[model samples]
Target: TTDSGVGSTPAAEAVAQRLRAAGFPEADIQVIGPSARKKNVVARLHGSGKAKPILIFGHLDVVEAPKEDWSPDLDPFKFVERDGYFYGRGTQDMKGAAAIVVTNFIRWKQEGWVPARDLVLALTADEELYGDEDGVDWLLKNHRDLIDAEYSLNSDGGDFQTRDRKPYSIAVAAGEKKETILQLVTHNRGGHGSQPRKDNAIYQLNAALDRIAKLRFPVVLNDVTRAQFDALSALESGQVAADMKAVSRDPPDAAAVERLSEDPYYNALLRTTCVATMLEAGHGPSALPQRAKAVINCRIAPGHTSAEMLQTLRETIADDGVEIAWQFNEPSDPPASPLRPEVFAAVRKATDRMWQGVVLMPGMETGMTDARFLRAAGIPSYGVSGTFLEQGDGRAHGKDERIRVSDFYAGVEFYDRFMKALAGG
Candidate 1:
């Protein structure tokens, strides 16, 4: 169930009605929650054999896009095909995958092909806006039985060709960084704007923000990232490979880590990162603000906790007047799903068959996803998508987000085969 928009419900019922019209039995398909704009769309393709169903998951929610900022041709809700790509708010960020899943389900039914394992499709809500009322979170909490499965594929990772469209990098997100909201508050005496006080709250808050901006958190590597770096190192050139290898070693080579940190991607993987995102101060035009607050969004490494990170931040920006407040903290470590024989073999065999020996690297996602919720429930979840995107597609949450039509269709093929193989075994 994807949040239609913030408080708005998605048009999932319309999608659900379409599924029912496509020959899905009423019992085989279930729409949970109210019949509002946003709701979960669930469809089951019953398997023939004894294998447990494989849950195929994606979100229907797209971040809100202001029409004024975009080009006249770009409308967030309209699915426009332009330059071989589908232009929509949810095109690449996710709804495209959902559409593929829905299409695959309908096609599977039409073919009358019963798989070895059932395929469960769940399109959920409230992901773009991080809230407790998320579909996955709600399901895990209230309706765990509906999602019982041996394995699942989240809609976040996949193979994408290089800028030159040569080789492909098929990333499988094995884990993700945890989120910690750090609130920093500085208190000082209030006075008229014309007559400023020595201990101004804004000034003090600015100093803390400045320190946070300049301060560098120490690098802390984990098992997943180590493997990622090692794999990338093998593919890179002379200096790049050498640098990546150095940083991937035990007791990380400080020089190499420092140098590689210059590259933002590798840098974030190696350390706990904190960025100041929101700030608030002052009430009126002529009044001096008594208190100032800034929110720092920090993605903690596996072993660290919110408290520990907050303490580090407090110590880093040493100031007795500035007090740190925590807005929210959720543990982000995914339960152990070994990249060893059993799980790895299935993924490798499927990916290799589809991509013709593309590199399948077990990587950590910098951003969070529904996989975290599943992992917390002792279910092994892998963030793998079957599509590919060209270079310069922009980050998931960035502007002009898009995915190629070929990539979308390729995902259907890859997932169809991959799911069949996984369930067959």
Candidate 2:
């Protein structure tokens, strides 16, 4: 188990040191970062100098887990297997896959096997926080040549849905939504609590929030979403299936839109979504609120701009009194990576080889990942983890996180086939 942000460096360095001890050359291994506690480990294996290298990367970081919150029998750090599941903090979120990648690297070296093209492993740091000292961003800016590859395969993406322990679909993330934060601040003169005015800052802020809630960004579809619906339609039944097929059409079905909009998950996929996440108002309980502010968090759809969304917010509120501004750490979002046929084909072949008859679907992730940075850096990255978790059992960053032992072992085999398909034997 690893601490959310601080554990990445030591854990990564430990992996690098182990590789070196296993006779891996020092020139091919590096522990790079800004400080001692925040390092990223990178390693490479030389192959025939024919094709561009393929990157297999995952962050060592996992979200914080407190022992007090978990069941007594389940400790966050202790590895335990019960009822076919491996219980641990980072079991499902990522360390499971991270360990798999590192193990594969070691196994390949021990077996004296080399691929047709070079393979790079970038076990990074600060991906969970994604602050100024992001590992992937630093590497791209300062040491691009070290980890640069034709494309990258990240364990953060592909999602497997199962029911009753039977795997259904393999959803491979081809793109992801961008994150944007907008601040809505309302300022007014404070008077005695005895005289509450209509233009009170708190009242104005509440009104603005109501308007924002009622406002719906226009429905838009991209290549990824369309393919997602096309593939998902087969799995769904009744109105859900019809709605999925309808949304995939050139002119989306309006009734279908209304129906799906009722569901938050599908609604987020249909268009950019915004919600008031943080609120601040009033100095004291007895005082009139002089200033009221809120932080609006948005997961914007691909091909949409924060500027456009801000404009829409202003128009939706239709009020000049509420002042709005972008957050200081606004996201510098990258363009959605274009879907490539070969990449999807490779994922499908790998999935079919491991779990035959499982559907491979293209998806756009609502949450952000390091893949965005790689995509912006001109390295097409895909999220295609081999592990399967039940439909509602994805305990990422949640309490009592665990993973199926069978799925964990299966991923090792899946990745082996996947790398061969992409880089050739």
Candidate 3:
């Protein structure tokens, strides 16, 4: 849900309404948050007291989509079904997955089929804001008992990946890079706009940024990414395939690294990335003489620390003049979730039933997700929703965002099966 009207209250209420209709007591259907406009929905369906509870979750928040930025025929807020596709802002990242989770939960509740363990459904807000005041971490901190489970199944990260609208592989997110930010601030004496100084704050900060831009983190791969390159190596052929195999090994061939780094996606997968996202200069447009600040957002690869990343930035910028500090940083290190065999087996069972010839493998998320928080809390999280998207067409957080209707329903079935298999219903 976007902030255009009320916050995520409507979506949370919708989930609560369905749970209540399915005979869930008001106590079981909780709409909780700091305010009415911002809240999260948490409910549990009981089962036999045989195993640990399972948590299934998706974020209600979607990235903002300015109406003007989208195609003229489409509005980001309205749900439009055309050409076998459903178009909207959060259809893919990921109100759609939340809907599927709720649908399957209510379906099981209505059928009165008890599983081996309880199923917890958490439809939370502010995940797009990195779990703000109303997101998963807030819920975990405020009411951990309500949603505690053995493992969390994040429905945002997809299980099935389709390149060129064809099945490429079933990817389970076993690794996620850490998310952190470093702020650079420069202070200088104020003067008139007509009087320029070489020691100006803006100029000094810009020089440091220029140096930071040219900086590149070293190439490395954790278990998930190494497995990804190994599986994709077979799918690709010729020089690309050879490079994938080459880069998968330690002390990777220098020539292969150079060739693969040419692709932006592969490069991001290969190394930690830090890029300037926000900048603020002098207080007034006419005055650029006082201070300048810049925020460099970094997605550090696994097995690294915020301290290490900070040191890297300091050495790269090599500017003692520009003060650098952290801005609400999370732990830059969370050991990669172990690639459990049972989880992969369940994912493969569902994927094989749907996409025949598709390969199954573990992968890493270069971007951050709520899974990071859960993992840090010692609850290993597996991101294996069945959502499949066409390659080179992921418009999440961009204009004209959409998901194929076929893929959506297919994902619903796949997720339902995947969960049932995991829980042994």
- Per-candidate Cα RMSD to the true structure, in Å, reads 2.7, 1.8, 2.2
- CA deviation > 4 Å runs, candidate 2: 1-5, 328-331
TM-score, structure 3 vs. true: 0.93
Per-residue lDDT of 188-239 in model 3, one digit per residue for the tens? 9878777777778988999999999998888878788888888878888999
Worst 10 residues of 2 by lDDT: 1-10
**TM-score of every model?**
0.90, 0.95, 0.93
* Predicted structure 2, TM vs. truth: 0.95
Model 3 ranges off by over 4 Å: 25-27, 190-197, 282-288
- lDDT score for residue 110 of model 3: 86
- In order, what lDDT does every prediction score? 0.73, 0.84, 0.84
